[model samples]
Target: MSPFQPWAHGLNEIRFQGGAEGFSREALSELLENVPLAIAVTLGPQQIFAFANRLFRSAMGMADEDLIGRTVSDVMGDRYTPEIRALRQRVFETGEPQELKDASLMLTPGTTTYWDIKLLPVRGGEDQISGILALAANVTERVRARSEADLQAREAALHNERLALAVEATELGLWEWNARTGEIFWSERQKEIFGLPKNEPATYEFWLSAIHPEDRERVVGGVGALSDPRSGGGLHAEHRVVHRNGDVRWIVSRGRMLYEVVDGELRPSRLLGTIIDITDRRRDEEVRQLLVQELNHRVKNLFAMTSGMVALTARTAETPKQMAAALRGRIEALARAHELIRPAITGSEPSDGETSVAGIVEAILAPHVNQGSPSQMTFEGPSLRIGPKAATILTLVLHELATNASKYGALSVPDGHLRITWIKGAMLTLLWQEEKGPTISGPPKAEGFGSQLARRSVTDQLGGAIAYDWRPEGLQVRIDLPLSQLNA
Candidate 1:
C-alpha cells in the first residue's frame, strides 16, 4: 500500500476511536479540544504537560497556554508532596488505575479542599506506560460534614465520661438486663454497691441472691411487672437489702422496658435502670423523729419545775416589790437555760446549735441592770458564736459578775467600765475586768442565787473552771472552758 493510503487508514482509525463519526482528523481534534470535561496529555519519563483542555485550565484558574507546557510540579508547586509524587510514579510504573476517595488538599492559605482523585495510567502503541492521567472531583463539603460528625461523636463520649464520674461520686449505680436472653449487666460500681464479688456472674439469680431475703421477693415482683408487655413498661420501687456481711441497706431501683425487633416481631428486650443506697439518710430521719419526741417530754418537765420554783418564791416574798423582782429574775433565768437546752433536745448538730453570745449576755444582765443605776458594760472578742451550754453558762457567770459590779464594784459608778473581753485559745477564755468603781474588799458575805447558779453552770454544764480575784483595779473573774464543750 502507498504511504498516503497508510496515513489515510491511520486517520480513519483515530477518527473511529475518538467517537467522531464521519469526521476528518482536524474536526476530531477540534471536538476533543472543545469538550467540557477536563483532559490532559503528558509525555513519558518526565511527565511534562503536553496539552490541556479549556475545562482543565478553568478549574485551576489558569489559562490553557500557561498550563500546557508546565509539569504538574511547576503548576502545583509544593502542593504535591514527595509522598503523593511517589504515588503518581508508582501508577506510571505499574500502569494501574489508582483511586483515592475523600482525599484532602490545601489549595489556599486557611482554606481546605477535599477531592476524589483518580490516577489512570495512559498507554502508547505497544501498551507500554506513558504517563498518569489524573482527574480530581471536589468533595470538600462532604468531607467537612464527616469531620463535624466525628467531632460530635468525640464530644458525646467526653460528656458520657463526665456524667459517669458524677454518678460515681454520688455513690449511684447503673444496670441493664436483656429480657430476651435473661442476661444482666451491672456496672462495676453497681457490683461494689450491692456488696457482690467483682467476678460474680451478672444475672437475675446473682442479683436476687445478693438482695436482702425479705426484700428479694418484692424486688423480683416489681421488676417482673415492669418487664411485662401487658403493663406498658412502667416499673419503680425502693426497698431494703441485707448485704453479704449482714449490713442492712436501703436501695431504690427504677427501670423501664425497651422493645426491640427479634426475628420478625417486636418484643421487650431490655430493662435499663439505676440503683442508689439511702441507708444513712433513712437512719438520720428516724433519729430526728425520736429527738422530736424527747424534746416534747423535756419541755413538759422543765415547765413543771419552773412552776414549782415560782410558787415557792411567791410564798417567801415579804412584799410586792420583792415578789415582782424575784418573779421577773427567775423567769428570765429559766428562759435563758431553756434556750441552751433546746438544741440538745432537738438533736441538731453541735455547729448548728450556736446562739448569739451578745443576746445571751443581754438576757443575763437585764435583771441586774434594773437597779436604776448607770453601769457601763462592753463585750469584745473575735466575733464568736458558741453552742447552747456555753451560751447559758457564760450568760449566768456574766450576770453574777454584773450583780457584784453593780452592788459595789465598777458597774456601781457612772464612769466605771466593765470590760468583758473573751479571747479564743485552745480553750475559750473569758476575762471580766472591772475598772474605776467602788474600793476593793474581800470575798462576798454570802453565796446568793446569782453566785450559786453561776458556779453550777460553769462547773457542771460547761465542764469548765472559774476563778474570782479581788484585784486592786476591780473584781476580775476569769473563766476557762474546753473548746469541744463550748462548741458542742
Candidate 2:
C-alpha cells in the first residue's frame, strides 16, 4: 500500500467485518471524504493524523496539509484536557479499540459538538496493529434533546417541593375522599389532624367515628348538601371531633364536591378538601359572645327600670303643664327604647319587612330580663321563620302576657319566672307558662282591653286558637296557629 494511498476500507472490516465488501480502496477513500460524519485515520504510536476527510477537515477549518500528519493535540489545540488526550493515545500503545457514545468535542474555537465515536486498530493481517481507524457520527441533536428532557424533569420535581412547603406553612391538612368506595387518601398532615398513626389506613367510617355525636348529624347534613345544585358543589362546616386519645378538637372543613354523570343522573365521585383546627378561634368567639350577652342583659334591665321610673314620675306632676311635660318625656323615652329594640333592621328591608318567630320574640322580651331572670322568662324551641304579619300578631300576644305578668303574674316577683316554648312542624304551637307567681284564682270573668286584643290577634290575624289554663301555681296559655296561612 502507498504511504499516500489515502486510506483503506479496513475500517469497515474491523467493527462490521464485511460492510465494505464491494468497495475498492480508492472508492472507500472517495466515500469517506464526502460522508456526512467526520472521519480520520491516523498512523501508529505517535498517532499522527494520516487521512483527513473533507467533513473532518471542514470541521477543523483546515486543508489536507494542516490536519494530515498532525496529531489530535496539534489540530484540536489545547481545547481538550490532558486526560482525554491520554485516553486517545492509550488505545494506540495497547492495541486496544474503544467505542464511546456521546463523546464531547471542542476542536473548533467557541463551538461545541458531540459524536458517537469508534476507535479501532488496523492490522497488517498478522493480528498486529499497523494504524488506528477513528470514525464518529454527529450526535449533537440527540444529546441536546436528552439534556432538555432531564432539565424539565428536575424543574417539575422542584415545583412539587415548593407546593408542599406552601401547604405546610398554611397549616392545612389536605385530603381526598372517594365517595363511592368510602376510601380516603390523606396527606401526612391530614393523618396528623385525625390523630392517626403516621401510616394508618383512613376509611370514611374512621372519619365519621371521630366526629362528636352532637355534631355528626349537622356535619353529615352539611356534606350531603353538596349534592344540591344550590350548594354549588361545595361543602363547609365547623364541627367537633374526638381524637383516639379522647381529646376533643374543633375543626373547620372546607371542600369541593366532585361529581360525574352516570345513567343520566349526577353522582358524587370524590371530594378534595382541607381541614384546619379551629378550636382556639371557636373558644375565643364563645367568650366574646358571653361578654356581649352580659352587656345585653344589663342594658335590658336598665331600660325596664327606666320605664318603671317614668311611670312613677308621671304621678308626681304639680300642674297641668308639668304633667304634660312629664308625660311627653316618658313617651319620648319609650320611643327611644323601641328604636333600640328593633334597631331599624340594617339589611335588605328585613326579608320584605318580615322576620322569624324567634326574631319577634327576642325583640319584644329583650327589655325585660337579665341573666338572673332566665327562670323568670326564657324561651325553648327550634328556630322558625315567619312573615311580618304573623310576627306582629305573635308580638302583640306576647306583650299582653308580659303586661299581665308585670301587673299580677310571674314578672311581679323576683323568683317568679315565665317560660315560653314553641314547636313548629305541621302547625305552629306555642306554650306560655307563668310559674311561681302570685296564685291565680281563675280566668278573669270578663276579658280586659289587652286580653281582647290578644284574642283578636291570634284568631283573626294569625289564624290560631288561644286558651288559658288557670292552674293553682300560675297561668298556662296554649296557642296553636295554622302554618299554611302564616307562611303564605
Candidate 3:
C-alpha cells in the first residue's frame, strides 16, 4: 500500500453509512505520522498552531509536543509576516482551498526551502470555518530548474544581441541557408551590401542574378563543395558581382556547414556564412603597389641624371677648384628640386598638377631661413599657388639664384644681401635683386653651365621672358610669366 493509504481509507470509511462517528484518534495519529507531505493546523485571528504532523514538525526543526497550541507568530517569530497571516486568515474565512506554487519558506538564517502549498479551511459541525489546514510539498528542485532555464534564456538573448551589433558596426552581412528545405535567410546588411533596396524580397534567384556571369559558376561550385557531406571542415571564396546599376563589386564569402541525421544517414542541413565587400580595400592595395614600383623607377632615373651631370661638369672644368665648385653648385640645385618633387611623386597631397607656388618657395627657403645670420636672403610675394610643374621650375630658378649669390654674388660678401620679390599684375612679375655686392661688369668670358641652364629654364621651359642688368654696385634680374600657365 502507498504511504497515504491509511488517510484515504479513513476518509472513505467516514463517508460510508454506519461508519465510525468521527475519525479514530489512533488512526488520525498514524495517518499524520505516515504521510510524506508536511501538515499544519492553525485556529483563529491569533493563528494558534493547534496541531502539526511529524513531517511538519521535522521540516520546522521542532517537536510536535512543543508546537501544539502555540501562536504561529510565537513559534515562527519574524518569519511569519502579516501578509502571510492575512492569506491564511482569508482561507479560513472562505472555507476554500488556496494553492500556492513554489512558495519560498525560510527555516533558519542560512537554510531555506521551497514548497507547493495548499491551504484548506476545516469547518465545525455548525458549518462555521474554525481552522486552517495546510499541505506543503517541497518544490525546491523544480523551482531551481525553472530559474536556471530563465537565466540561460536571458544570457542567450544577450549574446545574440552582441553578435548582431558587431556585424552591423562592421558593415558585415550574415546569411544562413537550409540546404534540405532550399530556404535562405539574409540579414538586412546583406541586402545593403549588395546595393539592393531594402523591403525587396530577397530570394535565391535575386542573389544569383546579382552574381557576375563569369563568377556565378565558380560561386555555385564552392557552395556545393562546402555543403557536401563528403567534403571537409569549411569553405571560403571571393567573387565579383554586378549591381543593378552595372557597377562591379568584389565580395568574399566564408561559411561552415552543419549536419543532421535523418533515416540513419548524416546529411548537411544548413550553411551559415558572412559576406564582406572588399572592392575599395582591394583597389587601394593595388594602387599602393603600383606607387611603390613607380617610386623605384623614378629613383633609378634620378641617379642616372646625376651621373650624367657629373660627367658633363668634369669634362668642362679647366681646374680642380673650378670643377669642385661647379659640382657643388649644380648638385645643390638638383637636391633642392628633388626635395620639392619628392612628396608629389609619392602621391601625397599637393601632388603633381596640384602644388602651390607659395608652398614651393617656403619649402625651398626653409634651410636658409634657419641660419643664425639669415639677413643675407629676403623673399616677398603675393598670395598664390601653382601646379607641380610650375612649382618645380620656380624652385629650380630660385635655387640657381641662391647658389650664385652664395658663391659669387651678394651672399658671397659678409655685408651683402639678396632680395627676392614677386608681384601679381596682368602677368606675374618676379625679381631677384642683389645689394652691397662687388660690381658686376658683364658676363663671364664664357658662360658656365649654371648661367646657361638658368636662362634656358626661364625662357624655354617656363615660357617666360628674362632681363639681366649689370650694375656698378650689384646685379638685378627680372622675369615675367603668365599666371594661367603657372597655375595650370
Off-target runs (Cα >4 Å) in candidate 1 are 1-41, 44-46, 50-70, 73-102, 106-113, 116-130, 133-149, 228-232, 260-267, 300-342, 347-488
- Candidate 3 residue lDDT tens string, 1-488: 11122222212233323336655656676777768798887877676887788888988889988898898888877777676677787776776566666778887568778887777776665667767777778778888998999999999999999988998888899988888898988888888878778788678888889999999998888877865578873879899888899999998988899989989987898989899999999898887886678668657855865686678778887988987886776677667666666665566654433355566656555555536764677778987766545665677677766767776788778888778788999888888899998778886687655566667767786788878787767779898888776842
Q: What pairs collide in candidate 2?
A: 376-417, 376-418
**Model 1 Cα displacement at 230 (Å)?**
6.0
RMSD of each: 12.2, 14.9, 8.4
Best by TM-score: 3
Q: Which stretches of candidate 3 lie above 4 Å from their native place?
A: 1-36, 44-54, 62-67, 93-101, 161-171, 212-214, 246-249, 263-265, 300-337, 346-354, 357-488
Task: Give the whole-model CA lDDT for all candidates, comma-separated.
Answer: 0.71, 0.73, 0.75
**lDDT string, candidate 1, 1-488, tens digits:** 11111111211134334353566655655775776445666667787887666656665667877887678888878677776687788888886666666766667667777776666676666667776666566677778898999999999999999998998898778898888778888888788778887898676666777777777788788777764577888668788866778887887877789987767766788888888888888899887887677567557845764676567667767988877776676666666756665766565554434565655666666655536655477777876777655665676577557656775788777788887777888888888888888778777676655566678768887788888888777888888998888654
Instruction: Tell me model 2's lDDT, rounded to 2 decimals.
Output: 0.73
Question: Which residue ranges in model 2 land beyond 4 Å of their true spot?
Answer: 1-22, 27-37, 52-58, 61-66, 99-103, 107-109, 178-183, 212-235, 256-271, 299-488
Worst 10 residues of 3 by lDDT: 1-10
Error of 1 at 202 (Å): 2.3
